[model samples]
Target: MVNESSVLFEKQGHIGILTLNRPPANAYHLEMLNCFNTSLRQAINDPEINAIIVDSSSEKFFCAGADIKVFEANTTEENAKMISQARENMALIENCEKVVIAVINGHCLGGGLEIALACDIRFAAKHQYLIGLPEINLGLIPGNGGSQRLTRLIGVSNAIQMLSTGDSISAQEAYRMGLINQLFDSEELMPAAVALASKLGQGPALAIAATKKAVYGGALLPMAEALELEKRLVDTLYDTQDGQEGFRAFVEKRPAQFTGK
Candidate 1:
């Protein structure tokens, strides 16, 4: 296990586990945000880790968002710098070759929701949990990618309503809006997240990574261009060792063992 002042990084089999470890609310301070970025880079560079799961040590908060005290104390210049760093941190999560899953154990709002938005998938607990982009309530807007990402994930109408109203949604509502992939009982959340990560960890890593790249990269392109991009990615995957192994294993009537090469 690798421990930072604000986050805990550990590996379970082939899955890397990153737990947000700040106190009562798990709010992001500048130092915690920097530590989080460093921890994420460490996980990305670890060859043994195939997939990652981001969770929280807090029982009541996946993350309450930026620390109010810190925000209040910062000057305009300092706030700008912090916002830039937060965006960079989220970008790291988005661009990582390996899949990253956010396991939301409790409340997720504002910057917290933005963090989950960057992940490839999000799984949340069924009880005592709320998720939203509520920056409007603070007389500010989401400085992170919440505005863009939420609109892309759910649609502009829903995203506007959520962000403008500064209201939290229940787990069921979040799932319905496609903000979260799935929900589980509070007691079963972590185990379920681990199971899903393990399943992805054992898949053809090259193909999986390619799929992520194609989807996210193509989402903003024209339809014709997106299709072309998809074709290119698929062709690229065809040359991978795991690609050949997959076909061979199919013909041999055996499970494919992918080495991520």
Candidate 2:
């Protein structure tokens, strides 16, 4: 049975794993978006959650993207509302202080790909796993940051080809193009994703947040402005408890325990 919750939350140490739980294709229906938004915000606000890994419950499809049937049923205003909700879902990943990772084990298209694009990192299984923005097939464009983020990630030319042709690329191609950070054998995908998330969770949390802000913020800013922001961030972080612990731990040859302060 597909839980009415539409999402499943599991915490393992500092890592929060969020699985899209709508079975079969795991399509992004209105309820799914609401669940994702709520769960992501909860994870982000929880001080104990150092990172988040988004995966899927279904084995054959990470997410089949937006539920086109729902779109077809909606009026213009309703469409706008749905798009706005999806964008809010994207923001829950993008603007989060902790790391957000997408673990794609199977088909990831349209809104599914858009969600992955919003994350700081993506890892995919090597088999039939696919990734693309296929909204053009429905005579629509991606609404949830796919157009802009895809271009920023894989260049304007490739983004156009993927979106316009509605062709999904394999995990290898995505990795080669840097769309995905890593690709693993189908059997190893989840374990690898979780291992990576755990490794990231062990780092200094504030430093990770600052680094993410620096890169993501810099991507949208002028070089000079970005550099100044980074400078200020470095200065601010230098005074944090985690910063002091990091230095002290290095001198003492021990693992640093970061409080995320």
Candidate 3:
């Protein structure tokens, strides 16, 4: 395990696990945010690690959002800088070649929900945990990517309702709204996430990365442009070793041993 201030990094097989380690609430402070981004870059650079899971060590709260005290003390300019930094980190997660999953073990609110939204997939605990963007309660709006990402994930009506009221939703409600990919009992959450990540890690890496790029990049374009983007990505994958290996394995009636080449 690698410890850096409030974040803990660990590798299990081909999956890199990042735990938000600040006790109780696991609120994001400037130092913790910096450590999170640095650790994420390290994980991304490690070729052996093909997938990542972001979770919290705290049992009661995945993350309570930013440290309230810090926000209260900072000037508008300072807060803007901090928000920009946070959004940059979120973009790193969104654009990662390998799949990144947010394993929400407990309460996920405000910036916490923003972080989860940035991930490619999210799995939450099924124990009635609260998850939402409650910045309105503080007489502020979501400073991170919450406004945009939330609307994209769920619909505008749902996003607006949640944001306007500052009301948190249950884990099941989040799943129903497509905010989270799946829900599991508290004890089963990490294991389930690891199992899913391990399967993806062992699959064709190049194809997986291309698919992610195609889906995310194409989502913002018109239908015709999106189809063209998909075609380009599919054509580009034909030159990859893993692509050939997958075809050969299918013909040979054997499991492909993907080396991520």
Task: Give candidate 1's TM-score.
Answer: 0.98
Question: Weakest 10 consecutive residues, lDDT, candidate 3?
Answer: 76-85
C-alpha RMSD (angstroms) for model 3: 1.0
Which of candidates 2 and 3 is the stronger one according to lDDT?
3
Report lDDT (CA) for all predictions: 0.91, 0.86, 0.91
Candidate 3 residue-wise lDDT at 197: 94
Clashes of each: 0, 0, 0
Residues 1-261 of candidate 3: C-alpha lDDT, one tens digit per residue: 999979999988899999999987998878888999989998999999999999999989999989889877989887777787789889999998999999998899999989999999999988977999999998988988898999999999999999999999999999999999998988999999999999999988888898889999999999999999999989988868888898999999999989888
Predicted candidate 2 versus true structure: per-residue lDDT over 63-166, tens digit per residue: 88878788788887987887888999888788887889899988998888888899999988888667788788878888888999999988989888988898
For candidate 1, give the lDDT of residue 64.
Answer: 88
